[model samples]
Structure formats: C-alpha cells, structure tokens
Target: MAQTGWDDGQALIPPDMYTDWTAVALLLLTAAPLAIVVGTAGFFIWKQKRSSQR
Candidate 1:
C-alpha cells in the first residue's frame, strides 16, 4: 500500500476558522423556545385587541 501524505503546497486555514459548532447548536435550541413564547404572546394580544374593537 502507498503511504498518503497531506498536500503541503495547498493553503491551510487556521484552527479557529472552524467556529464552535456546539455553541451554534445550543443557540438554535434556545432560540426555538424563546421564539415560540414571544410569538404566542403576540398572537393572543392581537386577538384580544381585534375582538375588543369588533
């Protein structure tokens, strides 16, 4: 079997270029619930105002 080596001639990215995927995942998870709460509250408030005006 031939031993394969990295192509050193190619440009390489810095390690930090790979941003923390875990943090992104956590943020998305947290945002879902928060968005649901805000949306639900706004919906109820709008409904109440609409009914009162009718």
Candidate 2:
C-alpha cells in the first residue's frame, strides 16, 4: 500500500483480507476448523431429522 498509504481507506493494492494472499491464507487457516465443525454439525442434524422421519 505504499502507493496509497497516506490515504484513508482506499488502496489500489492493499494487503488486506480480500486481495492479499498472505492475509487470505491466514483467514482460511483460522476459519477452516470452524467451518469443518459447522459442516459436521449440519450433517448430524440432517441425519437426526432424517432418522426421526423414517
């Protein structure tokens, strides 16, 4: 962001979560486990409902 460091919030190539690879990797690594847990819970809920229906 050397190009727009002085500006407030708009940068052509800012190293934030959207465009920066390092930041994106950090975010994915942090959120992957939570995402897996959410998916597992959803699958279990679906299985439980299906079993009850049958």
Candidate 3:
C-alpha cells in the first residue's frame, strides 16, 4: 500500500475541543488554595473551642 499522509495519524484532536479553558482552569487553581485555607482556619477554630470546653 502507498503511504498516505494520515498513516502517521497526527491530527487526532478536533479544533472546537481547543476552546479556551483558562478561566475554568484558573478557577480550579484558585479554589483549591482557598478551600485549603478556609478548612485549616476552621479546624483551628474548632480545636480552640474544644480545648476551652475541657
């Protein structure tokens, strides 16, 4: 069989699937840190209250 250009199979991804996801990506990036900070602060506050009650 003669070699076709597609034999290498380079163009797998469709163009529309390439739409900008930077905002969504950034939201995820920031949300993780924010959640961590809030969770840590809440845990400390809870620990303080629990110790005070003893």
lDDT leader: 3
Top candidate when judged by TM-score against the true structure: 1
TM-score winner between candidates 1 and 2: 1
**Per-residue lDDT of 1-54 in model 3, one digit per residue for the tens?**
786545567757644466569988999999999999999999999999999999
| Candidate 2 local lDDT, 1-54, one digit each (tens) | 366453566655555526568888999998999999999999999999999998
The C-alpha local distance difference test score for the whole of candidate 3 amounts to: 0.84
Residue 34 deviation, candidate 3, in Å?
0.3
Q: Can you write out model 1's per-residue Cα lDDT over 1-54, one digit (the tens) per residue?
A: 562343454547643367789999999999999999999999999999999999
The Cα error of candidate 1 at residue 23, in Å, is 0.3
Which candidate would rank higher by lDDT, 1 or 3?
3
What TM-score, over all chains together, does every model reach?
Answer: 0.67, 0.55, 0.62
**29 in model 1: Cα distance from truth in Å?**
0.8
Checking candidate 1 for backbone clashes, the offending pairs are: none
